[model samples]
Target: MRYNIIHRTTYKYESPVTVGHYMARLEPRTLPFQECPWHELTIFPSPIERAERSDYFGNTNVYFEIEGSHQKLEVIARSLVEVIRAQPFDPASTPPWETIRDSCRSDVYNPATPAGELTFASTLIPVGVPYADYARPSFLPGRPILQGVCDLNRRIHRDFVFDPKATDAATPVEKVLKQRRGVCQDFAQVMIACLRSLGLPARYVSGYLETVPPPGVVKLVGADASHAWVSVYCGEVCGWMDADPTNDVLPSERHITVAWGRDFADVSPLRGVTTGAGEQRLKVAVDVLPDKD
Candidate 1:
């Protein structure tokens, strides 16, 4: 499937003046599951200086400085990508929960992968056990599996919610687990913290979700926004399996990768700091459209 994405983020300030710098991670990368043939980003009221580099996590970073006195700013990113992903339905060959846990230890790392760092502590996912002794799906009849890390990707999906306002970027895992509401980022973080707590490693992913409406229903422009998820290492044979806890499904052709890192802070689409502003307001609009024939 091919898609054309247009994302516009506008900031309207009550008062604006002086210097500002921003970090942007809006470009998509070609991974095993998707192909990004073309991608571009444009900023209105262009900045005075711009620099681009790859972060330690292998995510492309764009840093720019804008110096002036303006009350409004708008940044737009557009891209066209062709995605091809495969679905593997066999579950019997899936490793048992214990084996997956044992494989993920604090010392495993894949230098070849973009992140350049891979280990069990980084991959182990966290889970929240309402009761410390409850029986988990991947655990023995009487024992409990750790809170975040699940043996299989399918289990992660079944145990989370996709509430946009459940938590903000600053919310902690303990709080999110207590509220039981959060966006994909929250779920991914909880999973990461759990994995790390158990001496495993995990990483966060940011991307887009291809939404298909029911038959005869018109697709709304900008209705589909960017998405977030996580990945955990399960030994060399199983490798890193991507899981979307928000949607409760494994990644398929419907998913597109933009960037990845330890957490959302490392790969936010847009982040910046400004001096000399009493207050500010922000508005965002995103459109993921199928390419025209």
Candidate 2:
């Protein structure tokens, strides 16, 4: 499926900013499952200096500096991407949860992926009392699919509320789980942390959400918005399965990939530092339109 995405962000300052800087991670990367045909960005009152580089996590970073007093700043990003993701429901010969767990041991669990990336660490994802107790040896390994790393994805959907204002980017996973409310980013992070606690590799994903309109109704334009999810490596055959605990669904034709990384900090669409700006307000708007072809 193909989509044309338009995203605009504007910043207003109470006082004119003499100097400002920003880091942008809006470019999409080509993966085994997705493709990027064209992508570009434009900033209003163009900055005097700009630089681009790739972060450690493989996300593209655009940095810019603006000099001279300015009351407002605007950044616009547009992209046309052709995404071809695999169907989650595709039948395979992989063993079920029971057979897989029986062949695996708790001590042998490691969260590193085949590529040698540490997908999860204890510091990032601590195992709570309930989680540790539930995975003990006395329990029936096959029966407690809810005890291990794989269960983090489903547990989040079953336990939390999709509250947009419930938390912010800095909120911790324990807090999110305790409150049982947050947006897609929050849910994705919690899942990432939980999976890592259980020694599994997980990563955060950023993209666009495709809205499904009622029958016979044309999909609402601009109704679509930015979305976040998590991808966990579930062994050799299953590879990485994208899960959206916020919506309790898998990535389909509707999910458009923009970027991915270990966490939001690694793939935030826009972030940066500034000088001479006492305070600033930000406004953002996103539109996802289906291609006619």
lDDT scores in order: 0.68, 0.69
lDDT of 1 by residue, 73-118 (tens): 7889888888887665344454454554554532564432422243
Q: Kindly provide the TM-score of model 1 when superposed on the true structure, using C-alpha atoms.
A: 0.82
Model 2 regions lying over 4 Å from their true place: 89-116, 121-152, 214-221
Best by lDDT: 2
List candidate 1 stretches off by more than 4 Å. Answer: 94-136, 139-161
* lDDT, residue 63, model 1: 90
Give lDDT: candidate 1, residue 227.
88
lDDT of model number 2:
0.69
Question: Model 2 Cα displacement at 193 (Å)?
Answer: 1.6
Worst window of 10 by summed lDDT in candidate 1: 141-150
